[model samples]
Target: MESTEPQRYRFTGHERVFHNVSAIEALPEVMALFGYQRAFVVCSRSIRRKTTWIDRLHARLGDLIVGITDEVGEHSPLSNVLIAAKQARDARADVIVSVGGGSVMDMCKAMQLCISENAYDRESLLKLQFVVSGDGTEMLTTSQAPAAIRQIAIPTTLATSEWTPVSTPIDDETRLKARFVVPDGSPEAILYDPALLQQTPVRLLWATGIRGLDHAINTACSSSPHPFASLLAEKAVALYIRHLPNLGDTTATDSFTQCQLATWYTGMGQMSVPHGFSHWMVHIIGPYGDIAHSDAACVLMLAQAKWLEGWVTPQHDRLLAAIGQSDTPFHAILHDLLAGLGMPTTLDDLGLTRAQVEAMIKPALEHPLVTRNNVRPIKTAADLRAVLDLAWRA
Candidate 1:
C-alpha cells in the first residue's frame, strides 16, 4: 500500500540516449561525433582486468585516450576523485569517459566538475545553489567558474548511476559521506553495449540486478511516486525478473539489451525519488565491510522490503501489480525471487553479527535522504534500533 505522500520537487534535463552493439564500433565515432577530441577514460580495476572492450576502445580511438584511471571502487572517495582530476588535467583532457558500473559513473561525473574548476575545492562542492523550482529548464551556472569538461558514459554493470545528476563520494580528509559536484553536468553522450556486460562476473551481474530492482521498488513505493517514474520502475522490475534468472544460459543479444534498458529505466526512476532505507544501509555496509556495492544491496533488499510492508498502503499493491506481479504479500514473492537468484534474503548471510546490527543503528539513521523519506518517522535511535533488530535477524 502507498502512503499519502505529497508530491513535491521537479525533475530536469533531456534524456540524451544512445545504444550500440559493440563498444569498438561506437566508442571512436561517439567521441568524434560529440566533438570530444580527447577524454580521460576512468574505469574500475576489476572492470579493466575482466573486459578487453577498453583495450579495443583504445585501439579504435587511439590518441583520443588522453588519460586512464582504473581505481574506482564501491564509492568514489575524495582522494580518488582528486587523483583522477589531476590525471585528467595532466592529460589536458576535455572530456570524461566512464566505463563501469555506478561507482565509475559517479567518479566520472565528479571528475567532470572538478576538472572544469566548477568545484576545484572539495569544501566548495557542498555549497552549490540547487535549482529546486525549475521545470526541465537548462541554465548556464558557474561554480568556481564553469570550464568545459564534457561527459561520455559507457556503463557495463546494471547499477543505474548514469541517469542521476549527483554522485556519492567519501570525503578525502574527513571520511564523511559527500556528494560529488554536479549541477548542469549531464553526459553529452551515453553508449550502452550489452556484450561488455557479458564480461561481468556472474555474481556481480546477479547482485547489481538486485540493486536495479531496489531502485524500482523504492521509486514505486516512494513517498512521492510519480506516474512517469512508476512506469519506468514497473518495466524495470519485470525485465529484471526475466533476465537475471537465466543470465548465464541466455546469450541472446536481446536479453542483455533488456537488462541495459531496465537499468537505465531504474536509474531514471531513482533520480527522481532517490533511494530509501535499503540503499542507505547498503551504502554504509559496503564501505564499512569493504564489500561490493551490489552484494550489499541485494542482501538488504528483502529484509528492508519486509520491514516496509508494515507501512505499505494500497498504492504499493497497485505498484506491485504494475510490475507484473499479483499483489499477494509482496515480501514473500520478493523473498522467493531473492532465494531463486541465489541472493541472500537475510542480513546474517553477510557475516553481520548482533553487535554489527546494533552498530548499524546510528549509521543507517544518520543518512539524511533515507531517514527523511521514511513514511514512518524515525524519531530516535531506539526506533532505528528496533527496525535494525528485525532486519538484522531476518
Candidate 2:
C-alpha cells in the first residue's frame, strides 16, 4: 500500500527487544522493573536436556525461579499446556519466562489463558474457540475478562513467536489448534542471543528460518500491504536468501545472527500487515496434517508461487527483485531453495493422505483470514484446489 494510504499498527505489549545480549543476565533487571518475583519457567525439552541453558537459568534466578516444566511437545498439545498451567498455579508464579521456539512461546501464552480464565479443564479452553460461519464470518467469543498472566521470552529459534501475542496450541483430543489472545499477554521483553541458537538443531534452524522466510514473503504480498512493512519484509527476504541455505554447512555465528535479525524483520510489522494465501493455508494444513509449520511452508509457498506465477505480477516482480532472482520464475527459485536446504517440496512428501487434504478444504475455505484477505479472492472450490494440487507430489 502507498504510504499515503491511511493505516494503523499497534505494537503489542512487548516493551523492549535486546539483541546479542545474554537473556539470563537481562532477566534480573527486567524482573525487578516489573516487580515480578516468583517466576514460572516453561521451556522446550531440548533446551532442558540437550543444553545447560535451563541449568544456567536456575542458577541465575535461584529461588525466584519458582517452577520449571520441560514436557513441552513439538506442536504444543493443549493437554500439555493445561498440565503446565496447573504446575505454574501450584507454584504461584507471577510471570512466565518462555524459552524455546514457537510452540514453547505459545504454550506459555496458553498457560496464562488457563490460569486467568480459570479454565484448566481441557473442555473449557477448547470451547473458547471463536465460531466461524459458512461464509467465513467469525465471532470473537473469547472471554472479556483480561488474561491472568503475561510473558517474558528468550528465543531459541527464528520463528519470531516472541514478537507476537497470539498463541495457537493444538487440541489433542480433536487434533485441531486453538487460538488465544490474552490481555497484557505479550512478552514484556525479548532477549535474542545467538548463543541460544546453538542449542537448536541445524535442521530445526533451517526449518524455522524457512518459517521466517514464509512470514516475509506473505507480508510483502499481503492484500492490504503497508509500505513500511513491505520494506522490512523485502529486506528480510534478501537476508534469508543470502544466509539460510548455507546455515547448516557453514554453522557460523555470523550467519545465525543475521538470520535472527532477518527473523525479527519478517514479523516486526505483523500488526500492520495482513497476510494471505500460503500463510493461512499453513495454519490449517500444519495442524491437520500434523506437519511442522516450516515444513508446510516448504510445500505451500512453492505451490502458491506456482499458482500465482503470472497472476500477481507487480508484487511478484518486487519480491523477485528483492531476492535478486528476477531471471527465474518465482516457484522455480523457491524449488531450488528447498533443494539447497534439503527440504520437502510437496504435501505427499509429508505422508498426508488424500482424505486429510479433502477434510481440510471446508475449514480452509472458511478461515477468516483466508476469506477476507487472501491476495486473490477465493470464490470456488476450484480456486482453493488449484494451489493444493500444485503442492501435492502426485
Largest lDDT belongs to which candidate?
2
TM-score of each: 0.88, 0.92
For all candidates in order, the CA lDDT equals: 0.71, 0.80
Please give, for residues 71-186, the per-residue lDDT of candidate 1 as tens digits.
87657887788788878888988888888888888888777777666455666665552332242212223355454676778877887777766666766665446644365456
Show where candidate 1 strays beyond 4 Å: 1-15, 118-147, 172-175
Tell me the tens digit of each residue's lDDT in model 2 across 202-292: 8888888888888888878777677788889889988988888667754577887898899788868765666667877888988888799
lDDT of 1 at 29: 74
